[model samples]
Target: MAEQSTSAESTESRTVLSWSGGKDAAYALFELGTDDVTELLTTISENGRSSMHGVRQKLYEKQAESIGLPIRFVELPQECSNEEYESRMADVMAEYESLGIERVAFADLFLEEIREYRENQLAETNIDGYWPVWNRDTDEQIEAFLDAGFRATVVAVDGSLLDLAFAGRELDSAFLADLPENIDPCGENGEFHTFVWDGPIFDAPVSVETGEVVTREVGDGKFHYCDLW
Candidate 1:
């Protein structure tokens, strides 16, 4: 864990952005100014891969570099229980609170339950949660992301919702046009996950090459994720 130094209390709040190294997160930071942001916080698996998108640590580092922010990665066990997840996250929040950080921003869109859960959790520590891309239409958001000059690739897809071939596919008009009606255009339902490699917010585009696809089963759900190196 990375520690932040304590500073004098101020009327203005100190904030951190929850980064997932994905298009949504990248877009959120761009849409929301970063002048008061403390750091980019993210969660990674025990093996140093992004817990959600499965992007490797090296690629994540490149993303942070391109976005020009210091990232703090919270490590989670390979097979952690929900209880452990909450405990670990609580500890991280407590640490940030001690440093005078008062809020964390997320990139959730049209997910009331998720936003509510995050707010509830943060309320426990007197910290607030901000959702920059909340309540937006998925189709419009995806189109805006592309029009903003961001480039991303589908890194993971829910095995039950999409074919394995969806992994490693560029996130563009063709990809969105090919998605089934049941799938959300912005992947807000977790039908798929993406890795943003370039965008207006990035100082430089991240260089990556697709690698072998790997599958993992969690509970009854399976995910097919492609590696990038």
Candidate 2:
């Protein structure tokens, strides 16, 4: 019995995934591991509130259970600016410092400025940024993320760059192939936003209904989003 148990435990894989309510991070985690990777999903929740990127804290709790992974949450405020963002990140890092987190990962793909920012930031800390999906052609990247058995919808779009109709549609090859040439296929320039569904990274898919397609004129441009519930 001891030998059998030891063998089973030996075969178990482990890793931690950075959580965001989006497809890029979901796909990165999918490629990294699928079965019980450390059981810990980490994310920064809204300050004083227990949610990540508008995801309910309880929902995340259920998600971790469904994936058979444990969860760790850090909270931050909704109106956080760049300085505040860094301070909160420092706090999270301090708590996990002794645990020897070999690397940290993100949902980024092919945005030079964002990548540079993350890399430079991590250079100041013990943890280093690991970009799993970087520099791939937009079509190929989107196709791969889709073909990897993951699903996602456009949760938001910058109205100035995209039509409001794009706010709540499934991300499939056809939609991607048909994207207007002027819009960045990956939305790297903030053309669109996504929420993930069934994928290799999830033991069970996240269930959400598109709530509302809202268009608001803010500053110099109008933005659109699909309220997800």
Among all candidates shown, the one with the greatest TM-score: 1
Distance from true location, Cα of 115 in model 1, Å: 1.0
- Cα lDDT tens digits, model 2, 1-229, are 0000001223244344566657777777677674634434444545422332344555556555555556666555555567876776666555444455556676677778888987787786677677777777877777787778888878778887778887788887777866788987778777877767677766777777777787866558777867677
Q: Pick the candidate with the highest lDDT.
A: 1
Candidates' C-alpha lDDT: 0.84, 0.64
Q: lDDT of candidate 1?
A: 0.84
TM-score of each: 0.92, 0.80
- For each of the candidates, the C-alpha root-mean-square deviation to the true structure, in angstroms, is 2.8, 6.7
Regions of model 1 farther than 4 Å from truth:
1-13
Question: Candidate 2: which stretches are off by over 4 Å?
Answer: 1-16, 35-63, 217-220
Model 2 lDDT, full chain set: 0.64
Clashing pairs in 2: 39-69, 39-70, 47-76
